[model samples]
Target chain A: MSHEIPIDDGYLDMDLLRFTTAGSVDDGKSTLIGRLLYDSKNTFEDQIEAVEATSKKRGDEHVNLALLTDGLRAEREQGITIDVAYRYFATPKRKFIIADTPGHIQYTRNMVTGASTANLAIILIDARTGVIEQTCRHAFIADLLRIRHVIVAVNKMDLVEHSEERFNEIVAQFKEFASRLNNIVDMTPIPISALHGDNVVDKSTNMDWYEGPTLLYHLENVYIGSDQNHVDARFPVQWVIRPHSDEHHDFRGYAGRVAGGVFKPGDDVIVQPSGFTTKIKAIEGFKGQESEAFAPLSCTITLEDEIDISRGDMISKPNNPPKKDQLIEAMICWFSEDSQLSPRSKYILRHTTNEVKAVVQEVRYKVNINTLHKIEDDKTFTLNEIGRVSIRTSAPLLFDSYRRNRTTGSFVLIDAQTNETVAAGMIV
Target chain B: MEEERHSYQVNHLAQLESEAIFILRETAAQFERPALLFSGGKDSIVMAHLARKAFHPAKLPFPLLHVDTGHNFPETMEYRDRYVAELKADLKVGLVQDSIDQGRVQEEKGPLASRNALQTVTLLDSIEEHQYDACLGGGRRDEEKARAKERFFSHRDDFGQWDPKKQRPELWNIFNGRKHHGENFRVFPLSNWTEMDVWQYIKAEEIPLPNLYFSHDREIVHRNGAMLATSDVVVPQPGEKVETRTVRFRTIGDMTCTGAVDSDASDLDSIIQEVATARQTERGTRSDDKRSETAMEDRKKEGYF
Candidate 1:
């Protein structure tokens, strides 16, 4: 019965970030995540007495903290934030996970499904409407989802009074429209006030002439550790344990999750579209072996020479491999609200733990996302559209280049007759 | 930004236990009647300890289901029968008093009566009596506000409901779990966990739980500001009084609307220091999410987990 408990293990040195915000219900982005979870105490007291009794039964004169991350019931009777919600918060250094997408111009496939596993991207911008067009379509969907750390924020800044010349004219008009976002890699900007809690989670005593670092200290100091791809190894095989047991008879192993570089225990690897190689033999880890395993560690390995890997195989690193393809080209994002993208259509694409049977074959242009241009005459694609297509598949995929590996460069499509998930590719 | 960029990172509870062991090995390589919904709670005993590290030496390729709500807490039925007989795994219960003596549900009647929404008709009648195309749950999109619009692969139809405006858009850790023809799929590999990352991953996986989550004395009954626990399915009205007190629960659901609190903070590092200074919300002492404000989005659009 050890009672002293001040609780240390300091959350085992806390590390996890995952960002993605976007804007539109008046760009406060749910009042900057309800002022960073109510000034970082992580909002409670019966969720602020049920958002102050639904902001005093909607007569509302304050206390709206975007009615605390809005949620369902037709988005709290339509105040907005229609889908991607995922909030969570933490502070003694880190643990965030926001995702909160949705910024109207028809949700753009919920901001490309909350910028696919974001390693940062906040966006917001409303400091008295400076970088509009929904802030260049939220920095072009955080640069078409390669999202390597963004932020921009600039929110209300107490309705532009704590100015700093309108926060350096909306951070030089959002770095001249996010300098045509070539896969971001750190943008930053700040100046907050999600309803007078300026510089979010403490710092702006009315902007002491704006000295920076506060949207929770640039989201608890963002480096996003080279946003993953420790250097090409991969992994894909999702499951194949085979215990056909008698206490320990021929165990087999493979399992998955590493999805990119650094894999060890003998390491020669290769397996992909059945290229074969082998070596690893013992990385294991559910509380055992593991001499190494990387990118996103969920171990198991064990090989040494029995190849024939399964669940859409792809163990990698033979000579930095990955890119087997079968006529691809990507950059998609449609997300079907009752379907449209034409050409040869087909679908069920999936990728990573692979799935195949894809068709499409051309439509290659769309972009316009708030003038990042290239509309090339509306190449018919519907629901939240963002184009460049060219598909083909029915086999060979194991890839990379969502700017080099966001888990073997992403893929989604599905809808081979309404199995839904419609579109969100990337690879190009 | 340099402790050499926190040296190849990984911590947040080992990247949420390697993204819940990669969505439980992508629900054991995408369903064929998948199950794991179990509720011996601490998020399904840390989702059956990450489904025993997601299929370790095999054996759990499915069954743990539970749905029982026959008002639990006999120390969660002896820790769900000694942890499903120490993970030789495969349990399956489903009762809710056999969906209320087979009328398929109808019991809630009075002084806060609650079969907690009759365990969603015995969990959609045990996923259509096991036609179960994937279930998995320990749902944690930081516990409700309609589970922060959950979706680690959540889709459900052929009647097990949940449509939070037609979900299906989860990208990247790519999870489509395609379905139709008596469809299903709940999945939530602890959808990005956070009840302080499941009490710091059950205090870094020492994971044992059920002594009704520490601090105990019992009796209880303060109501509406919460504390309730006077179980025998919580009967204590007419100007309530039953004291005893030290109390403890903070979410295990259904000993009549689960709500316990007073605490001495027994172990698991003083219950993660009383859940990091608890300010009410582990479902704010959930009396089934205190009835409404879209009560957990109308019990997740009628397919309540």
Candidate 2:
């Protein structure tokens, strides 16, 4: 089966990019992902054959690309996506992970879940229905999650005759609304027709007035290597690897993924909550010794002196330590249907690798996702509601502001009774 | 922009490995009694290798559990024993034969009968008997459409049922493994990995796999547009003729349902190339998924990993 195609060594150097897609109902979100996957040669022939057969059975005119993403039986029967479905594809330049999420009012939690770990977000806008409330809601969620890059794909441009004026009008409307968002570093608007494959993978001949890169080209070339916070070094120790064998009797290494900044051997560090200072004696990679470790890399660090470090403790630079506080304010998106969040409600707050009992002290305000307006009078939060609240924990939590570092500043509230995740929080 | 220039940059494979290791470690730290569900397949082998790397210089914290359907290929069983013995880890087996003997499950009767679906009862019962809180699987989203919508931390009810509509929203790297008594989680560290990524990683890391994955001369019977291996458990029916062909198993499962593809790829590089240019999905060869469009979904909802 081996062919004569030249295999380049550069193929092993491909990087990864994770992005989320959001749009209103019938906004062609799934279609865009399906087309991107199909054009990139990711979709298999059997998958297409299944979709084609289903489409013909359901009396569709063409092979419905949207059927590729609607995975669940209910979703396929109803012809809608109700949950976050992850899709994977790769090109010569990069490997892409798309978090294809729903864009309805009831599925805001799905969008937030998809956007939580994304480096970039793609918000689809139908050119016929320029910018609507659903667009604002998606943008607000993307901004609140602190997504750095956003691609405003104005789809269905062929329906509007590929009018540059229409595309510009939609872009202008998006910019007007985006002015209120924070932490949005870049927003690139591309005119595309996902159904017709126009300006999606290749440039469309119908839209000669548009002079922007194609969607696939932009996705492949976008730079996202500098997205992590590399200034404040923080490593939340998840486990302590102790090889009690005679071969390595003295092995006591801290195992964790580097949450923020860079860590190297011989760096002065402090253990959070314990307030003990130590120096890194060595760093262990999967195979051998590593000189340094950066954000998102999982490694083990052996300290110069053992100071009683365990799981849930953090390691950071002594000069710049995360704030340790019991009372913290954060913006939370409610994700529970069994109960509503109110004052005096107790739950288990999981921050980083630490879990502690926390009580809601006060509800400052709730924001209307459609308009991004604050509602100070609403003291109760139900499912899919976003609000700012203060919580007092049983113990002091070592954390940074979500604006500074996403890894250290995010948390989830788990209901101790039902053992279900009730809300997602970002520390302020 | 100038400050973005760094001396080192991790590639996609390295990044994925780190992510999987992180998840594996998190499961070890969070769960009280967890077990790795080993199927002796390529994905499980890759996962077991990652687990070894995650806790170097120390034995695995959890044991490996294999739900035996009594219809596995001999090569897979041989590979399973060798791998487990080399790791020096504990191994537990849940046999479907025992379930049938105890009157806990009934066997299907037909020419196309498979013990694949019957393993669910044995699996859930084993979890109950062992009180395993977390069971790590090698399920990848790219394998099936239902799996694409599954979470890395999939929750199961007290009755051992998965409610696809009521899944908890997983955010960032924070996984909620909290569960009440009798409830458990099915953790998949390789949820984000694709088929190509697995093969590439295996080749890059020089991971060992079963000989069944490689092409070999075997007696096969073409049935229902699929080439099935003629094993002791799978006998050829009347009008079905067995022929010798050079074939390889894309996925290993119950011999009755698992199918083989005719190919000539004998090595890692050749197999990778074959997978890259392959027209059908890995699961397309398996006759189990041909039962219905949502067969995997139905099985998954009933606690099938």
Candidate 3:
């Protein structure tokens, strides 16, 4: 299915990317967004006027860039961002979605929510202030969320006159600390002055001693093709679209976004759990049939010969079928306000498009993020804690390791009572 | 706007679009009765575009609801009619004049009177009359600070009140549309998009919009530092002078409420260029938002979209 094919629809030619930003209140996450919007010229006249009005109303000397993204009224009143304000800004290089997450400790759930779908996690650090505990906490969450790419932005370089010595010190310290992270890899460091527009879009001659892709350059050129799972073919059914409209009543195509791998119209595929084999029939989508389909593209597929496939059934090539098992081991970020991981606690686990009842079978060792070590004695996982655990589901889930494919490996724990999603887990 | 998609992990605009489409489908799948709020503005137009794409090759299952303040630019209504007819979607209009006639709401009696705020009452009455379970709106969080705290699936009580603290926690892609009798949900698919994104998307998609969005020669007068077009609703006073100038509206609402800005950006590219260097916020022209710091929040609490 993964073949070079020529087709038209030039605009949809773009691939999508989601990223999260984690930084302390002082690190200027909001300011960075404002700078990006302001420099990239994404902010509208009305919004800029509102920010200026609010800035004057608050009696601020300079235009408060942070005020631009701090959306909550209480947040603006308090002069701090409290919730995750997902911001979308596109450039010619790529369309970027910035999940501006809170750096405050109490808003850990918001951070986790932002981190869950991000392929890259940008950790902002105030250059004047070197590596701090807050930075460690954010980096830990990025790793825990399995974000393959990490950009450590040493912001506010203008404050220190773009000091190479200070930048090197922080970079060295960060690199050493990140190497200790068991889950983290692909660490990239860039010195930036978000306030002064240094290394954000244009390279700074002031930092000639440093040699690396500028912040914008890296964001524009980073290899994110491998971010998706193309090896493990897993499909979770969202909903079956029959249309049933005049033209096509016999269209019994299973519709869902491909969670991993590639599929074609005539490939040998296997339906999981049923142990059924069938030839591919048609790889259909909103734009109609195509020669190939890949991960994250929502489309419909009709099997060559009718087979038993329902909402939870996984689809993959015969050779690369994901392991189907009732017992699954995973690392999790607990996000509940009222619930904690306990033995025999039953919850609805929504993996991909499949929802099944899973119970906490055993309390696994909790890792100390600060020290990057496993705390075997501390076995209980509480809210906002990252830990290794095992779950036994009533039905088997076909999945790939989260490291291999985020969509296939990830699942959400929802409270059966309020129907509130409590935690996000990634299969280890 | 960024043309390249793979540079980042997810296309922000596409992610936002997909999320919007997902919400639209969920609205269609979950509610037996729903309506799309159409103000003929870019945001609402953007929502309509997404809705059309959500279930392409099929007509929009829901009707377009526009709360008329009885003080609207003639061009907006004309454009609204054309767009709906083109897409084959039903268009529903709730007139504030009827609400005033029925005494459901009393019009403000003063020089600076505006139906902008009063449209909420007629809107609520229409929703109740129609029993619409869900109302798809084009409100963006970046439009205002109060809106920033709003969830994509904002819940409203029977009386149409929005409580900041009472809002349900939005997690991942899961949106709770549950409500009791007389209660309805206001869906904002464009909540994450900024005004810039809307313009950029509109340009990229080549979506048709009202001529009011583009600059044209119009006679207008300055009042309270705002450029007000000389419509039937807006009359020039003894102190104010009306003059013809090239102006366009960034946001279109009640004629008494919407304000125009001086510009010559009649084409898509020029409009984007003007938006890129704009100095004032979009809502700066609307007198409604100036009522108070929490005006939008309070209005929203009252079931105002």
Best by DockQ: 2
Q: What are the per-residue Cα lDDT tens digits for candidate 2 across A247-365?
A: 88999989988899888889999998999998999887656787788887888899999799989999999999999999999999999878999999999999988999999999999
Q: Give per-residue CA lDDT, model 3, range B67-93, as digits (tens).
A: 988787888888888888888888889
The CAPRI category of model 1 is acceptable
Please tell me which model should have the higher DockQ, number 2 or number 3: 2
| Model 2 lDDT per residue over B1-305, tens place | 43256734667787888888889999999999999999899999998998988887678999999999999999999999999999998999999999999999899998888899999999999999999999999999999999999999999999789999899899999999998888999999999898888988888788889999999999999889898999788889999978999999988988998899999999988898898888999999988888999999999999998
Off by over 4 Å in 2: A1-8, B1-4
C-alpha TM-scores of all predictions: 0.36, 0.97, 0.85
Error of 1 at B91 (Å): 15
lDDT of 1 by residue, A3-99 (tens): 1112458775577888888877677788778878988888888889989998898789999987888888787787776788888888888988888
Report the poorest 10 consecutive residues by lDDT, candidate 2 chain B: B1-10
Q: Cα lDDT of model 3 overall?
A: 0.76
Model 3: per-residue Cα lDDT over A1-428, one tens digit each: 11121213343234456788888878978787788778786676667777799889989888987777876567767776666677766666676667787777645667777887687888999998899877887888788777879999999998988999999999998887787676565888999988777887778878998789877678767777766656566666554555567877566667556677667778898887787999878876445566766655555677887776776678788898888899999987777667677768888887765678999898687877667678888666676787888999999898888777777778887677756566778888
True contacts kept of each: 0.74, 0.70, 0.26
Q: For candidate 1, what is the DockQ?
A: 0.26
Interface quality of candidate 3 as DockQ: 0.26
DockQ metric for all predictions: 0.26, 0.57, 0.26
Better of 1 and 3 by lDDT: 1
Better of 1 and 2 by DockQ: 2
